[model samples]
Target: MNEFSDKLLQWFDHSGRHDLPWQQQQTPYRVWVSEIMLQQTQVKTVIPYYQRFMERFPDLATLAQAEQEDVLAHWSGLGYYARGRNLHKAAQIIQQQHHGVFPTEFDEVVALPGIGRSTAGAILSMALKQRFVILDGNVKRVLSRFLAVAGWPGNKRIENHLWQVAEDFTPHERFDDYTQAIMDLGATLCTRSKPNCQACPVQANCMAFKLNRVKEFPFSKPKKVKPIKQAKLLMLINNQQQVWLEQRPQKGIWGGLWSLPQFETDEALVAALNPSVKTHSEAVSSLVKWKAFRHTFSHYHLDIEPVKLVQEAPADWQGQWHTFTQAESLGLPAPVKLLLSQLESEYVKNG
Candidate 1:
């Protein structure tokens, strides 16, 4: 092992996070689940979800056998619906192709639905004690600053260079601890903003720190204005206090998740519900336009316009009507959940 790795490992033995839920058992299945959950999400946020997920589906077989809705329901508020969908799909593949065992081969692991190169490495190194290099977000920050790498790590040219650095620093022995140590360093000490350089183990040789430009090494993504997309959420209600919900298509945003019917405009919604607008206008009881809000995504901004329609006659809607309690338990987009909750609260307050 090199001096850099040695120092980091020593510090890790003393201060690194060793008691995370997944670390307790440290199986391939556990590590796989944890890695997926940690993608684009913080450790604190992933813990409760991870624990609840593990409790519900503790092993590969259980997860593989679970319904997609059940899996998504557990991951409802976690966001990034595709990850949950992929996790479930990957589990089924493992059951069918590998006899319900989490694959250990590097290529085989990476072939799974949600498992990427870095995630595959993490599952193997941390769970199987294999020597594999991982360059996750945290690792990228730690390495970019340590080596003073230029250009955003997302760029292919820069990413390849960072991958080499990660491979070089990785040790053959105690690969498990080394893998966890480096990630912990980035997450705890080498944070993106307000890093604790004094407590950093390798800060003495850190080029960015020496140059007093820790924030400049790992260049941020080139700024671009996120496009704004507008949509209307139709909350059709019946007398029994049930609301209309549709299962989103199996691909694209909020894939395979239950959500309110989305329409491009009020006219389009009216055309679908009532072909003759004049007759429909006379029969409708109450139509409410709630306050609009923005849900920002990585590539665009979603301007959500929620409309609550309390109609007496149950029109032949494309989706089914579910009670507020039933809808609460399904896999709903964060915005949809919030709107439903607000509507439900208002309904109870007046009565």
Candidate 2:
């Protein structure tokens, strides 16, 4: 075996995960589903969702045939709804255009909507062992520090340089093992805040280790403060124990997910009432103010106020109640889930 290959393999045997859920049944379809879900999300959180999603749509044909709502609902709690949307789109394309098979070619994978070079590389290498290099967040941090790469990595020139480094380090033998090992190194040892340097396998040869600047090596970029956005969320509950929910529009933040009615402000909600809402006096019955919540997104923060409402509303509104026990049926975003948990606790306390 080659030097990097031997070291990587040895490091992997002792340290790498041989037990991830997707790893247990390492097929292309299973691997692809897990990889897409893993983007900008952590493994700790992805496992349960991965298990649930796969149970819902086990194969490429099932995913391709699923309705957009079913797909979105399966991806409800996971942020970055676009990933689910594009996964559905890509599945359809593969089923129709490519005959229900995930394309092995790197170029073909990247051409799909919402897939970039790194994600394409991940699918190609991990699923097919075709030897493409991935440069995800964990990999980027690991590489930048190991090589002591300077400049913001998000820059194109720097990114390309890192890509070359990635390509250089990848081993030809045991393609899948090596692909996962590098990511594991970053996730387990070379962490962002505080790394387990004593336990790090590559410490002996790591440039940043020699310099004692591992954290600084992956230099920071200037960041604009994430703008703060506010919304008023209503938790409209009837005595029947059903809550009102609105399906978000199919784009932008939390697109195609179920959420409580979110308005810019309480006043705007009352002023520009829906014609359907205006027709029925019963719909305006009673508003019970729960504690307001503030949720922060990547680019913006949402100051949310979750209010509880009682009384009969127009039955024509396109929503239904799934008593608290069946709340899982409605795919909810994180903030809505948070609100529900709060309400549930309140319900239990009152009981």
Candidate 3:
């Protein structure tokens, strides 16, 4: 092993995390699920979710056989719904194409949906003890600071350079431990903000640390103004306290989840309810507009105006009516869950 690997391993022998849930069993399916869930999410937040998911779908065959709604329900409140959708799709593909076995070949693993180059490498190295290089966000941050890589890691050229650097640092033996060690170092010591440079094993060799510019190395992405969009969410309720819900189209935000009916404007919402009322004016006057809130996405901010309509839904309505308890069991977006909880609390306090 080189100096980098040697020191990192030495530090990892005592300080690295050894008891992560995924680290215990060390199966390809477990590692793949953990890797996918870890993307853009923190370790602490992922632990309970990971444990719950594993308990529900313990093996490749089990996950492959699960329904999309079931898979998505288990993934509720874990933002980035596309990850859950892609994971389910990939499992079904593996069941049919690979006969319910996790592929060992790098090409086949990376070809799976939501399994990018770094994720594939991580799964292979950690679970299969293969000598594959990983360039995940944590690895990228560590390498960027160590080598003082100049550009944002998102840039194609910068990413290629980091990949080459990662390839060079990968040790021939103890590939699994080495992979975990490097990731631990980044997650624990070399964090995005307020990095603990003193405890770092390779601090002496880190160019950014030596130059007192550690935070400057992994440059931030170019900023662009996120556009704000507006929507009116209609929470139509019946005398029985059942709320109307519809499944979102399977290709957009909150895809495949049950959600309140949304309209671009109040007029559009009124029009939808007009058929049940004597006049459009009567429907508009009946809407009780509650507090509006903002839910921000990566590319835009959605300003939501929740309007309550406490009338029985028309029999011809496209969606079904469900009590709050039933809705909680279905896959729901974070905001929808919050609104349901609020409504439940209000009903309890008032009654």
Candidate 4:
């Protein structure tokens, strides 16, 4: 092994995380799932989700056979709905095209939905002991700081440079250990905030450390104000105490998940509730208004204002009514779940 890999392996023997759920099995399917979950999410948050997911869909065949709604239900509050959608689609492809086996070829793996070059590299290296180089967020941070690579790593030029650096350091032997070690080093000592540089094994040659610019390396993305969008969610409840829900479109925000009926403004929502606009006119009354809040995504913020309406029977509403308990079991967004939980609590108290 080269000096870098040698030192990293030595440190990993003592400090690296060896007990992650995916590491115990190290199958391509398990590693692939864990890697996808780890994308833009922290390890602590991923552990339970990984365990629960594995229990629900143990293998490629099982996942491929599952309904998209059930699959999204498993990933309900995890966020990034597109990842869940892509993961389901990829499983079907693997089952039908690859005969239910995870693809082994690099190109084949990369072509799978949601599996990018880095994610494919990670899966291959860990599961098959391939010597593919990886450049996930943690790896990028570790490398960018170690080499003091200037410019945000998101920049194509900077990312490509880092990829080359990754190739240079990757050793032929013990690559799996090296892969996990580098990722561990970043996740632990070389963290995003208040990095534990003193304990880092590769600190001797880390350019940022030597230059006293550790904080400056792995430059942040250029800042732009995230656009704010507003919407109203109608929580129409009937005497049976079931709230009306509509399935979001197959694409876009909260896609494929069940959510409250949404409109651009209160006027639109009011018009929809009017008896004249109904397929069947039913008596309705305004109930208590819930506190409004905002759900922020990576590129934008959705300001959600929820209005609760009670009706004798919601014959006019176009969607189905689900009790709060039933709605909890469906694939609802995180904020939507919170709102429903609050409503459930109120219902129980009122009873």
Candidate 5:
């Protein structure tokens, strides 16, 4: 075994975790779900999502047969909705074409909707024990520091170099444990802000530690300034206290979800939902009060006004009560959910 491998193995045997929930079974399905959910998310946060997701759809067949709404409900708080959609899509493909079994080949795993090379490598190595190398964020950090590699690690050239480093250090005998150890070390000890240099087993060989430049090797790329956008939210409340809600289209921003009827401005709002919308009751003749606010997203900012529609729904416009409890159950997008929650607290506080 290599020096890196030997030291890392010893460290793992003494301190590594073997009791993570997903480690219990290590089935291809279980590992696949966990790895996908863990992308750009922490292990602690992924646990509840992984458990709840497995509880809802324990097997490939179950996930394949689930409706989009039901799957979205299970993935409600998981933030990245596209991952859930891709998981369902991949499951369906496996169920129909492969007889409910994921293919073991590296290329086949990568061919799945959202499973890229590193994810495929992880599945093949960890779950199937096939020879492959994964290059996740933790792995990138670990390799970059150990080799003192320069340039942004995410760049294609640097990524290719780190992949070689991963392959070179990976123990052919204890590949799985080795793979998990390096990742665990980077995640737990060699963290982003303040890596515990003393706790790292490979510190002697780590070029970054030797040069005292642990923070300098893995440089980040320049960030683009996020842009801003605007929207208007219409809250059409009635005497029975029912509010108007609409189902977003199946593709695009907040797709395949239920949310309050929203638009761009007064002109657009009227053109869409409130075109000649009349009063809710004689007591509420017209809108005498309205509210406005703004929200921000990853790629852009959103300027929004949650306009209270004192007017009732027309006889032709189809809508329902959509209670708070039911809202929790529905797949409301994050922004809509936030507003609904704020409005609920305000409703209770005012009453």
Candidate 6:
């Protein structure tokens, strides 16, 4: 083992986490699911979601057979809906192509949907006890600080150099422990902000720490103002206390999830509601406008204006009317869920 691995392993034995939900009764399938959920999400936030997901779809066979809607329902609040969709698709592919077994070969595993090189390496190392290098976000931060890598890791050249560093640090024995160790070190001690550098195991060798510029090593991505967009969300409630929801198109933001019908402007929303009338002035006047809110995504900000109309949806519209309880079970977006809770509370208070 190298000096880096030696110190990291020693630190891991004493301080690393051992009892995460996915760590118990460990399998390739469980590890795969946990890894996917942990991407861009913190460990604490993922625990409950991981446990609930494991409970619902316990095995590869079960996940493979489950419907897309059901898979998305389990992933409702987890913002990146594409990950859930890709995971379900990967499971099905594994079932059909690999005879329901998680592939052991690196090439085969990486070929599966959403399984990038780093993710595949992680699965092989952590789950299968193979000696493969992992350069996940945590590892990138750790190594960038260790060597004081100059550019943003998103740049291909910088990423390639980090991958080389990661490969060099990986040891031949106890690959699983090392993989978890490095990630734990990064997650717990060498965090993005206000890192506990004094307690770091490799503090002696960390070039960034030595230079007193730990945070400066891993350079931030170039900034650009996220464009703001506007939408009018229609909460069309019928007399039966059911809200109208439509499934978003299979590709794009909130893909394949059921959400409130959205239009670009109030006039367009009113026109859709009053298709038979030449002018929607009367309908627009009767609409109840709720407090607007902003939901920001990674690339854009969506300023949503919610307009509640207690009119039955036209039979020609392509959507479903579901009661509050039923809508809760479907794959609704976070903002939609918030609006729904408010609507439910209002109904209870007034009734």
- How many residue pairs collide in each prediction? 0, 0, 0, 0, 0, 0
Q: Across residues 1-351, which tens digit of lDDT does each residue of candidate 2 receive?
A: 456556767999987888999997677789888888888888999999999998999899999999988888788778888899999998999998888978888888888877889888887888787878888998889889888898888888889999998888887777678889888888888898998888887787888889988879687776778888888787777787677777778778887777877778665555344543544444444446667667888788888877676645555666666567667666679888878887877777987
Q: Rank the candidates by TM-score, best first.
A: 6, 3, 1, 4, 2, 5
Using TM-score as the yardstick, the better of models 1 and 2 is 1
Full-model lDDT for every candidate: 0.90, 0.80, 0.91, 0.89, 0.81, 0.92
Off by over 4 Å in 5: 276-296, 303-305, 313-321
Model 6 clash pairs are: none
lDDT of 1 at 70: 95
Q: Model 3 off-target regions past 4 Å?
A: 275-282
Where is model 4 poorest over a 10-residue stretch in terms of lDDT?
279-288
Which pairs in model 2 have colliding backbones? none
Worst 10 residues of 3 by lDDT: 274-283
TM-score-best of 2 and 5: 2
Candidate 5 structure quality by residue, lDDT tens digits, 1-351: 899989999999989878888898889999999999988789998899789889989888899999988888887776777788889999999998788998998878899998998899888989999978888999999889888888898788888888888889888988888878887997898899989999889999999999999988688876878787777777777665556677777677677777787666566666554445553343233433345566666678787767676566666764556767777887777777877787678677978
Q: What is the lDDT of candidate 3?
A: 0.91
**Superposition TM-score, candidate 2 onto the true structure:** 0.90
Candidate 4 is scored at a TM of: 0.95
What TM value does model 3 have? 0.97
**Model 4 pairs in collision:** none
Candidates 4 and 5, the one with greater TM-score = 4
lDDT of 1 by residue, 75-101 (tens): 999999889999999999999999998
lDDT of 6 by residue, 86-197 (tens): 9999999999999999999999999999889988999999999888889999999999999999999999999999999999999998889999999899899999987999
lDDT leaderboard ranking = 6, 3, 1, 4, 5, 2
Clash pairs detected, candidate 1: none
In model 3, what are the clashing residue pairs, if there are any? none
Candidate with best lDDT? 6
- What's each prediction's TM-score? 0.96, 0.90, 0.97, 0.95, 0.89, 0.98
Tens digits of per-residue lDDT for model 4, 1-351: 788889999999999999999998779999999999999789999899889999999999999999999999989889998998999999999999999999999999999999999999999999988889899999999999999999999999999999999998989998999999999998999999989999999999999999999999899999999999998887778889898888899988999999988888766666666646653212223434567789999989999988888764346555688988889789998988888888888889999
